[model samples]
Target: MGDIKPLEIADAVLERYRSLEIKEPDSANWTVIAGIVAEDTRSKQLRVVSVASGCKCPGAIVGKEDILKNNADIIKDSHAEVLARRGFIAAILEDKGLLRSDVRFHMFSSSPPCGDASIYEELDGSLRFTGAKLGDWRRESTEQVLGKTRTKPSRSDSIYRSASLSCTDKMIIWSLLGIQGAFIKTKITLSSLIVAAPHPKLIHSLRAALFRGILDRTHTFANEFCIPPPDLSIHVIANHYSGPAHCTKTKPSHLATAWWLSSYSSVERIVAHTGRLLGARSDSTKHSRLSTNALFELSDSQYQTRSEAKINSQYSILRRRLASRLIADFPADHPRKRRLLAHHFANNDIDESVDMRGALPLAKRSKLSPLPAYLLCSLC
Candidate 1:
């Protein structure tokens, strides 16, 4: 195989996008219903990627070539930014000799939530894809699965349970199984699976859930599909900007959080990648200006001329309180306890020379008190 040109790759992507179809029975009402169902399913998958990858709009998918071409301008700028970051990753992999000339790429657009798009790689006769799911975590609720009445399980749940029987008794079923048919045409073997999120703590929670799903059954999935569990690579992508330097209260970047959480996982690699920086002056609306000015004022008041010791101490106090709350919520032997403790001890050792010279004002401390536990955990 020879090197592929950009146009050729783009054409291939367009072709693949065009070939996707709603695999439902033909009927007048059924057609409409199926289309709606397919679109919703696709939207949820796209949401997973969007939240994880930090891409806002996964772009819209209309099945017409002319429409896609015409609307190409809408996504062109954002796509360029994403492509640049992905291209950098490709370059790094190639430099390390992990990528080869014959490597095939499959791009999925407007499909998954971690972002509006994703890229899959086929190299050395093996296939793999990366996915991300970011944002604040919420506990799954019974109402979400069972509906408002809670009379019975959702229709989707029944369908999924039925589908699991066709695979294997020993293989644990994954929610994503419903969409596996979309990848059938590629016919590539599994090699690696990279999952990313905005924060390392969130990634840790995600990793635990993923492993539970993967390990629930024996090697039923591997045996049935002729593919073993792929090499898992966890990552943190810094797609959002933390505010100015004097903002002692600003949360650490996703990249830094990922680094802190790296030691807890047995992942093959914990990669940190930077995306296009969001410009402060890009939005000129009054609301945007007001918010920016507010942040500046807050940083100036709380951080300017403040001794490092005072800042560290304030942060430590906040972290310890949050950690204590989380520890109380989880069981003594729970895996999350370990992560919380790791965070607590890690921050506890920071230079704590008591300095009351420039401490955060009591009023400001009271204002910060209502910060959500989830956000505080991220700070740790």
Candidate 2:
């Protein structure tokens, strides 16, 4: 069989988006979600999904096309960034031999979360497609992309009959099964967390866990590296689950755990991508003051429909700029503040030596700060 084309997956995801009832379905940032889907296809990364940003505007879907068109520039650029970072993440996974090129990640979110089927549903079809491709190719029954199907006599019932085909065939099949195992493992964790408290902080906690997973994949954990301390419980959970191994049994608990870990990774990555885009935009905004009216003009009605709460949530990360400004302007006698600074500096022990001898007050007194003088140095 010929290589499965990227457009096919893009088309499928786009269709799924278009078919949704704008108001009735779950709240998700469909355009951003679709863009991520399309971007992943091009990269040939297993398009594993995690929770998406859910939206709930009454008529948000009506102008989706136009909204997509308007934000296409930023969306495309953001998607590019996500794909780039994913490559770095993928390399980490590859080194550990846990990464499978054919298995994409699928994440689910709910505004709309309760009734959603388990995460296993998304990977099911893709795995089948991978299997079919291998099976046909091995049987030498593959046809031209445009050719009509023809029935052929098969001598062997065993797909494993051919060695060449078997490797790809079994790999795809088993990886998916492995993913199912992972999904189960993830689900269990998520359920327990939900039972405890479905607070917004839960999502943040989940993101940190994902960052840990990425670190693990990069072997950043194997070697001593400055990992932002994650919740001990989450760190324990994430450390134990590296996703599915081929021979792993698909215990119900396993699926729950895998899904939880993978889902957490998806949300974290998407949020990080969004933050990067917003940060880049915020920086540009600093240099050129776009009037609020002018900025409103740039926004689509869809964005306009957003509640102040929603808008604030989206821009919440921007507040770091303010916190950073505060740190830059912090007073000298603030010992507690100084401790906070210390943690930041300590984290950078993973990076290069920070030069603290600059003449600036913040620069000269790095011993009490959390951030490395280098970063604080840049902020100053």
Candidate 3:
């Protein structure tokens, strides 16, 4: 991996990645588009097309005139996933010495449709489709299932002769059909939309869990199977589950039920990228550089507030939005929504000592503790 400069322009981005060379960032607000496209193009390995050792294209793969029209959304999705991936993996790679000595890891969010949906945890600690809907939830869930053929009624049918559907089996069937509609009701979380490496230790643990999935066998990131270091940060951009506008219950679950999908096909490039962003070895004499361990430590820390007045005075914008969007979204007619909203607003706006009562169920709390102040302080 080599030092990758902070990508700020489309031309620089195109020059860096051979696959995106033809995809111009100039048309449709190219500057903003460039950074996003470049980041995502790398993160998702979209730019890594298989070629012979000394291969060259005979002609253009996609035409200039219709490129954006045909691939705008595809490009956009790749970009979001890329951004999320960088946040986690960069830290990991920095520790592994696979990245360059000049580039810096960066992460940012993009505008997209937002909302909430329901989330369910199965007995085995796996996510079950309680209900979640996104852009086209209904259409996405429809599927054709093949079941065994049954014979006509007979005088002495064995217990096995008659087909049976267990309640759990039937639920699975129903879930398949209504999954789209149900998924729409759940809110989306950052982890759900993107593939990110948790801390290096977390990634190591996840590798075993994900081994049964496709990620263990194939290279999903950077087109190579590379184990990312434990310190990197990778994040993804995604939308909340879609549902009726008035519902407020789903919003809290997004925060509480945070979990990561195991199979990420995009690890190799991101690992190399993390190495690139880490830049030169940390030097105490140098200014504005933090070691890989420090970066990971800070990202795993938490924030605390002592008073409502102080919280409002300090985080005014955050407070205002929390009150309006979170609290006000609850209607007077819905008691549960109103109460939940009020509790959420208070939990965020003021520093209440940790109390077990009236808190989220123990099972649903986030796996990652709140990030430390220093990690966010620089970004903020």
Candidate 4:
């Protein structure tokens, strides 16, 4: 990481994102792009391992084991950052060689992630990030509330709202639990998190956001989990594609995309990942293989669940200790926020810090189900 330039990595991600076929799906729809970029030691250049574009958060799928196993699309969290991270893990799970030999990895997003990090103020009539270091922009900002975790609503007028955490918050949790989510057993570490910065204040705000809120109260919650903060940087890239303006004429709110580096390239509706029209039953097609569950290996120890017919209804833990610690770590000021995070994350606080009598069963149960619900570490 010391030798690598964030600029090189950022440009590689932007270039790869631009090369995608579905990038220009429609003029009316513009989606945020985020992905994991890696240093290709063999080619001595940076390459995008995986990238995705979207703003949909189907959070209920996190606990719905039945839906996860049966659905072909199986997109529980459709934010570009989450999908891209999932794609990188999927690619790694398929080929272990990708992570071998000290190959460095970095996460790049087209814009500042949502929630606490994106808070800003008008400077010369343009929005500039206000939070920096230990600053508390949440209380000062007028557009959004400060305390407690927030949800990125699906739409303004919809009767229901999306349950997904903003990309910024998700990254904070990901740093603690590992981006593998419920997919793999091993942990993959990133060198740094880079966001596009056309100026300086945005950089300051991004720094404050990660240091202050990788998902809020970075000091209290993260320290308990023992996870380090992601190295942060901001670079001026040749292009920062933020997509269309908000409230523009679009269909279905907007069209989001999920894709990765695979033999097949089919961008189907979220309801139909097998390259078919919406509402149609899935088929024996290429995109079906791209489903998150399809990418999982059930027989392998890395796999989270075992659904082989008469086999026991056994699930596995992806980050047992981390889950336990985070639940225990939330500050007293925000009791509800802990539950909010726990709703999606697993909880298995059965380590030395835990009282096994109460936490052990939950830990066991978490390992028994694909979605057992749910952290921060301070050396970060």
Candidate 5:
């Protein structure tokens, strides 16, 4: 864990990705790739334990009502970062704290994450004329009034999942709350986070987009909720010709992949298209176990013993506080508060908030209440 040689960690993941020969994506179809590498406590050796590549989400095809209602087991967000984390949790559940602490964990991505990290409203060659470096582009964004949070961009004609936060924001939350997951009732975080594509100019912006934005905040939350930021760096990936932006030959493929190295069983991989397994029959129970619903139901019924019983982890309190930020505004009961929250969230542009009609309202801006978990993830 002490000063990893970096490139090899990223190279291992990239090699793992390139080695996958399933329904591999071609030049016309691209996808984002991300992985979690675990460091051996003794040998200090690095090995990739979990990896995922995807862009589609379940909320894309199904109606918003279906997703929020928990009507079925559907992968909530198929973005590589989220799915990869989901797969990583499988390791934790199998053996608690096996790789949850700073003593051993690293992350890698084939592309810069979307949102604050990936966006730059800068003109090309600006450095040649104005002497502004690429790193200064995001720093200058504050004055342009571009600080508003952005949802994951989707150009598909169909309504995609806009309710969830971008991968960048979620990763920041993970850094704070540990990717061990809520149900696990335990805490674990990344030691380092590395993303592909060498853009030395974007260091400042990438930091702000990754975890610096959260760390730079002045909040009233307890110090226990704060954790040291992961080692963030950039590396020039080999043969990383597939990304949503950097590669024009390949468009981001809707199909997603979730692959995890099982501690007990053989390696498992889930390849999904349009949110469901490829060629899965309608009657077959082929839902991705990593989906939100599956995590709750399956963990409760089966993997309960694998998780520690400590529900009062700093992250648990933080999640409640997040919900409380807005929930505190109303002293009323749950149902009524939800209705009131709809209005509070209406102007906030939170896609997760829905009124009685199960439809999103196009309302103008006003105020924002921090409805933690889903809300904080989306807005941040």
Candidate 6:
């Protein structure tokens, strides 16, 4: 394992897959895809299947061109997932001395429509995937409440489930590698978690708890599943746009939420702010290089206020357009849309001086803590 590079492993796995002569089903829907597997120092095996849409092998019923046009979003998301997987694999390889410690790996594009990925060499070379499954809880809850049935789970659902399973799987892999034990032997420095899209209420609560060092105690569904390291200095890079936006478009409210979240002491910085502008349709090489450099440069500094200001300035027009569209499409009585409007307008109104007096007692119980404090305050 120490002698093998992750790219080599990926190539070997893909070659084996090619040799299998697997063909898509007679129907136009089925496909074949790439994947990888590796054994650690202790002979413990870990396999990662690319979430990328299956490649069209010759004789497949469906053509690549048709799939590309119809399922563009799926392909884009799968590619991002594959890139993240590769980065994880590279980190594992480097940890095992298979790759040079100084080698930098690029895992995510600079812009949106594609998910964000950042590999930090300083924080024990840990790789972080931000916004991995954004908007999952909302979508799942909506579907359940509406009693909508579908043949497939939503994209957010798939990403959320996959990230959780990946965490559990990685824990197993790390433990098997002799990394963790009953007592913490070596601190698992590498941390990855899905940051939900910034709803104003959610962002405000997180910011408060993060400032107080009680984020882990808040017990939200996202916090429960995407565990972070205790050190708090491990550099939590917020990976944005990790899932398909078509399922849940990046409204202005979401950007405002992210802007506010960045002000928190816990959130180190954001990656892929305007995801589409950086990577939308073209190759993301330049943007990726620039973003990777930007992340590394900001690793030691405090949160940059100018970066937020720049983001606000750049997206001002787009945000206005999104606001206008929302207002036109959803009247005041529309439950979800109206809430979106409220979030858009309330970004600057978050009361930092608001006391957390009675909140801590109820939050400790977990039952009532899942609701954001902003929402509770609004009710009060």
Candidate 5 per-residue lDDT, tens place, 1-380, comes to 36576677877876776676546446577677889988876677777878888765543335323334332345556678777888887656554546434357788887666654554423353321111111111233332222223334443221333444456545555655567765565556676777764355655545454443333321222243454544434343433444342466446676777777764443334444345566665456766666554554544554356353223345544644443343232222345444554343333322222221112233322222333342222211
Best by TM-score: 5
TM-score of 4: 0.65
Model 1: lDDT of residue 376: 25
Candidate 4 residue lDDT tens string, 1-380: 56677777776776676676564445665566777987765666676788776655532223323232333344444556766776776677566677766577788776666666666443365545422111111233443544334444333321122334455545655665556544444556666777765355446544554555553454344566455644434343334444442234464224455566654565444431122224544432434344433554321434444532121111123244444344444232355544434543343111111111121122222222332221111000
In the range 210-326, model 6's lDDT, one tens digit per residue, is 222222221221243343323221112222322322123322111100100112222111112222121244334333211222222232132365343111221222223322332
The 10-residue segment with the lowest total lDDT in model 2: 187-196
Cα misplacement distance, residue 241 of candidate 4 (Å): 4.5
By lDDT, the better pick of 2 and 6 is: 6
Model 5 pairs in collision: 322-372
Please give, for residues 1-380, the per-residue lDDT of candidate 1 as tens digits: 12322223223332322233222121221100000001112222110111011112111112212111221111111221122222222222223232233332222222211111121222332322222211101212222220000001112221111100111111121111211111111222212123333343344444443343333222334354444443322222221222121123333121100000111221111011111122212122221111112222322343346232121233334335433332232222345533543343223211100011012123111111122221221111
List the candidate 3 regions with Cα displacement exceeding 4 Å: 1-320, 323-380
Evaluate all candidate structures by whole-model CA lDDT and list the values in order.
Answer: 0.21, 0.22, 0.21, 0.48, 0.51, 0.24
Which of the numbered candidates is closest to the native, going by highest lDDT? 5
| Candidate 5 vs. true structure, TM-score | 0.68
Write one digit per residue (lDDT tens) for candidate 3, span 1-380: 12332222222322323332322222221111111222232443212111100000001012222111211111111122222232233333233322323223332222111112112233455543321111111233421111111111111212111111111121121122211111011211111111222232333333332231212211222132132312222232221212211123222110000001112322211111111111223122221112223323333332243221111122323323323332322223345534543443333211110111112233222222232222221110
- TM-scores for all candidates: the values are 0.22, 0.19, 0.22, 0.65, 0.68, 0.21
Predicted structure 2, TM vs. truth: 0.19
